[model samples]
Target: MIKPYTNKAWYLVLPVFALVAFSAIIPLMTVVNYSIQDIFDANTRYFVGTEWYREILNDTRLHDSLVRQFIFSGSVLLIEIPLGILVALMMPARGPGSVVCLLVLALPLLVPLNVVGTIWQIFGRADIGLFGWALNSLGINYNYAANPMDAWFTVLLMDVWHWTSLVALLCYSGLRAIPDAYYQAARIDRASNWAVFRFIQLPKLKNVLLIGVLLRFMDSFMIYTEPFVLTGGGPGNSTTFLSQTLTKMAVGQFDIGPAGAFSIIYFLIILLVSWLFYTAMTHNDGK
Candidate 1:
């Protein structure tokens, strides 16, 4: 007969559970409460049910921002994933050179998000910024302040510069973790570099690529600080993503109920998309 099981160790998790409840659950409940009520003042709050959600769902502003958000996040994933793989492949396998390359590549990730935005803001200025100056010198009319296309390009370029290293580093670690025996077998078989990489390394990198894609998608989808600091959602609202729009509604306009509703919808959208990404990436893994 099996002995009676004891799960005393589970008790140790109580503090963590309590902490999550206090930090996340309570705040989420508060948002839900606010979403369902229209507040006139501290003493006057009317129960409005799902009116706020309905309004938010129908808002054209939300539609535009959501579209822009998808485009930006999609572009980021498409560019960064393959570029990162290439960078990892080109990186030295081992030695002091590898250490130096890693440190250099990691430098951009060390910078604060706001600081990265500020750097790009100054760097893209048409007055004295190097990039702006060079473009003007080449007789190119490149003013991000007045051009929506320019602003979009600048923001996308900045994101690539800021976040590509993270993908590269993750891919590099995955490449290094691969066993030497696989490479030895390929070499013994006189396999071409393309054949070895395609048959051996590419297959092994699937999990790592999935992680990178998910992370980049999430981060790009929720991105705010960098673009806000750089563009201020200007050039005709071309770069105004969902987060910035929500911030404007909640903080700028002080629309508490609608903002709360917007936040919940945003959270649900992110949750759903992230689940889709995970499912699509892992669907074939079991086979």
Candidate 2:
């Protein structure tokens, strides 16, 4: 007779579940509590009942930062998604070159975010930096500290350099999952390169592309460390994103009431957008 079914392994996972609840859920509830209150002291918090949220809803600074964040996140997805696919497609499938290519592409991801920013900061400096020296020699007037355009360009370029490898690696994994039979069939039919990519590769890679787009969008929208390190949201708010704005409100200015409200709203927006993306991507899959 067959043994009765059991799920005793679930007991092994209970400790992990408890740790996550203690770490994430507890702090989240604390934020939710703070978001609805006005505190004059540690023990003198008065229930404000969404007043902070209303104020945040009316804040013009938040509006501006939201718009800028949208632009940055959108640009990141636009650049990283297509470029990632192209890079993955060009990567070798086997042999020593493939190992070398993987290592090279992974180097950027290995660099710490703060270190990446510091590297670009020194690299972009106009006086002692190689990039600056070369640009000055060429008479390009490339000062990220003085011009908003230059600051924006530098920040965007830095982000692309730092994060593009993640997208490439994700897409590469998706590409490698396809069987040789598909390529053999394409070769048998004398398929053009574009046709093969369009019909076979693109279709197979769609799921991973969706994952890359969603991940990049979420991370880029909340980006703080690199830009904060590089420009300090400098040149008069040119590179100030939502996370920077939020951090300033929360930590820099000690506006806990508004910051808590701001964080909750921010979390909700991300949740809503992620839901939309997930729904749209999976809508036709079941059919």
Candidate 3:
């Protein structure tokens, strides 16, 4: 028997759709409007179609920041993904020990972003901070404030310390969801730990890894608050990422037209990269 489809239930979703349109669409349209025009004031403005975009595209600062953003995001993914998997594998699988492990692992994620940066900022001081003091005592020249490489290393280490727990937790949940029969089968087959993990665990972790990779990539790419608080995009602009650049243009310099154009470009880049990640992961899954 054929049944006619009714869309009456869709009417119930109208309010939610309207709210999203009001919140997101309105602001986005405003940015687009600003991007296309040079605004002198609320009453005084001139249409300058794509001028800001052209200028922004040619800006060398943008090029540098974009390159740095990619490097930072890539480094985070390479370190965090494997380190997270290792941590998850080492976590207690049962009893009160499991609860304790989860709590400890989750602690870093609970800290506020700015606070995490502040903690690290203080912790990395060579004067009184234990980390810097210890390194200096060992005759290591570790001043993140003055050195670009040190700043980069500190930022990377801080990011890993703060966010690796998220990946570990996600992986742990994925591991827990696997049926015990798979483990039993591996045992009966006399499988090596490496063989079992390589064939069984790794394949099962694909979806979760995809999720972790996408999330970590996006977050790392768009990262601003922590680095801004910690480094202020200083040490010779070495840590000045795209977000900081945008902020300097919009908030610091009040270049509304150019900032709007930059914002659009930034949003597009994120959208495109995220789409690529999703496509690649899903394509691999299908194979």
Candidate 4:
């Protein structure tokens, strides 16, 4: 008789499932409940039947924030992805240099988000700040406090400086995982530097690059603390992203009903986009 396959091991997953339900599902249900109601006070709430959702969909403030959010996230991916690959390519694969490079790359990630923002805030000031003084010395006309473009550029540069290391570290790990035989084969074929990168390195780094892209996208999309501390969503809301908008609705304005709806929509959008990214990246793995 043939042996029957069994799945009794699934019982081991019960605790994890329970934890997820408690942490994620219960909070989600609370948000869902809040989204469909109007709250007058702690003691008064009335059902509004998707009014908040409709309001959010039609809100121009939300639309503008979404646009700014996408632009910031896109710019981060554009810069970090290529810059990471270049950094990884230049990294030593062996010896003390590799260890030192890894440590240096990790330094930015080690700093707390709020502190990073604070550092950049003081570092970019016009009078005492080195960057500001240098720019003024060069007659560059830079003022992050008054110019919208300067504010955007400062936030962008800060983000790039803070997070590019994450992408580089991920790419480095992926590159280091490749077998030496692959390099030997490329050498035997007399592959040009571009050909080796295009054919060998690029293909191998695909999964890691995908991971970097998704992680950076999600983090950048929800970014709040750093920009909030650095620019306070000024000069005139140039750096206000989705999370900042959500915070303004929920905490700043205390519009719980609409904030709940916004939260649900925000969660759904992130989930949908992450799924799309994952699917697109892994679609060709089977081939």
Candidate 5:
């Protein structure tokens, strides 16, 4: 006879659940409370119902930011996903060389987010920065501070430099986890490199790629610190993303109710898009 599963072990895990409730759920409920009320001060607040959400939904600022955010995130996924796969394919599959490559790739990820922004900010300056100086020296007329397209290019490049390694490392681990028997079988079939990659390696990497895409998409969508320090959402607001917009509303303007509403909307958009990415990527699993 099969015994019923006992939940007594869960008692040991209860503290972790309580901690989550205290840390995340409580703050989330507070934001929910704020979203429904207009606060004039610490002691004064007026219930506004769903008014803030409706207004935020209609806000042109939100519309523009949403469009820009999607474009940036989309560009990130398009560039990093393939680039990462290429880098992984090029990485040594074993030996001291693999260890060295991993160390180098992991270096960028070790730097703090704000530090990465500051580094790029200085690095992209046409005055003294080597990257900018070299571009101007080449007669390309690159000035990120004065040109919108330049600013976009700089921001995109900065993001790629900083985050592509994360994808590469993930893909590399996935590649390494693949058993040698698969490669042996491919060899027996006299498969070309392209055929092997397209069929054997690529198929095995699907889960890893899914995780990378989801993570990159989420991070890119919510990106703030890098562009904020690098551009301050300038070059005519060309780089202003949803997070920056919400920050200005909440902290700069002190619109508690509206900011709360905006925050909820932003969170939902990321959540929905992440779910969509997961679904679309994993759709072929059962087949």
Candidate 6:
């Protein structure tokens, strides 16, 4: 006979839920309040009722930054996913070498975002940076500060360097979770290496790949610090993403109402895209 389930386990999680509500929901509600108001000061404010939202929706800066953000995010996913899988494939299945490889791959992810930007900023400098020096020495002209393409290249390269490891680690874990019986079965069938990977490994990795893609997409979409430090969204705003634009509105220009609306819309876009990703990936699962 099945016993009645106890909800005592929920009591253990109530504090964590309450903390999340206090931290996230409260601030989100405040932002929603701000988005509908025209705030001249703490004391002087008027209800604008979606005026800011309408303005932000029409703003040309929003359009450009949205385009740039998508381009950057798309580029990141395209480059990192395959590269990460390849790196994971090359890693030893069981050995000290695997430990060392995992550790090295994790090092980049361990570095703080601001520090990653700073590291790359100096590293990409034409005057004293090793990267810049080598390129110049090899008769190539590369100056991220002055060149738009180079700045784009630098930001993309930095993101790939910093985040590809996350995907690899996820893929690696998925790989390790695969039972050895599958490999033995493949061997008994005399399956080619490509067949083993395609029919066995890749199939098992689907869930992890989905998780990795979502994590990377969301994180990359919200990026601000790294590019800001590396290029300051400079060389004529070539690398200016939606986050920087929102920052400029909210902090730099102090357009709180518009910024709040922009942020809400930004949040919605991310939510929508993530939902789309989840739906597309899982659509075939039920079949």
Best by TM-score: 3
lDDT of 2: 0.90
- After TM-score superposition, the amount by which residue 237's alpha carbon in candidate 2 deviates from its true location, in angstroms, is 0.6
Candidate 6 least-lDDT 10 residues: 230-239
Tell me the tens digit of each residue's lDDT in model 6 across 158-229: 999999999999999999999999999999999999999999999899999999999999999998998899
User: lDDT tens string, model 1, 22-99?
Assistant: 999999999999999999999998999999999999999999999999999999999999999999999999999999
Better of 2 and 5 by TM-score: 5
For candidate 5, the per-residue lDDT at 283 reads: 92
Over 1-287, each residue of candidate 2 has an lDDT whose tens digit, in order, gives 99898999899999999999899998998889889999889979899998999999999999988998889888888998889889999999999999998999999999988898899888999998898778888999998888878888888888899889999999999999999999999999999999999999988998998898889888988888877887898788888999999999999999899999999999999988888888887788866
| Residue 250 displacement (Å), model 6 | 0.6
Identify the runs in model 3 with alpha carbons over 4 angstroms from their true place. 1-11
Tell me the lDDT of candidate 5.
Answer: 0.92
Candidate 3 overall lDDT versus native: 0.94
lDDT, each prediction: 0.94, 0.90, 0.94, 0.92, 0.92, 0.94
Clashing pairs in 5: none
Give every collision pair in model 3: none
Q: Where does model 5 exceed 4 Å of error? A: 1-14
Give each model a TM-score. Answer: 0.94, 0.92, 0.94, 0.94, 0.94, 0.92
Off by over 4 Å in 1: 1-12
Residue range 119-144, candidate 4, lDDT tens digits: 88888888988998789889999888
Q: Model 6 segments beyond 4 Å from truth? A: 1-17
What digit string (tens of lDDT, one per residue) describes model 5 on residues 1-287? 99899999999999999999999999988889999998888898889999999999999988998999999999999999999999999999889999999999999999999998889888878899999989999999998888989988988998899999999999999999999999999999999999999999899999999999999999999999987888898787889999999999999999989999999989999999999999998998997
Q: Of the pair 3 and 5, which is ahead by TM-score?
A: 3
Candidate 6 lands at a TM-score of 0.92
Candidate 1 lDDT trough over 10 residues, lowest sum:
278-287
lDDT, residue 268, candidate 1? 92
At residue 62, what lDDT does model 3 achieve? 97
lDDT over C-alpha atoms for residue 272 of model 1? 96
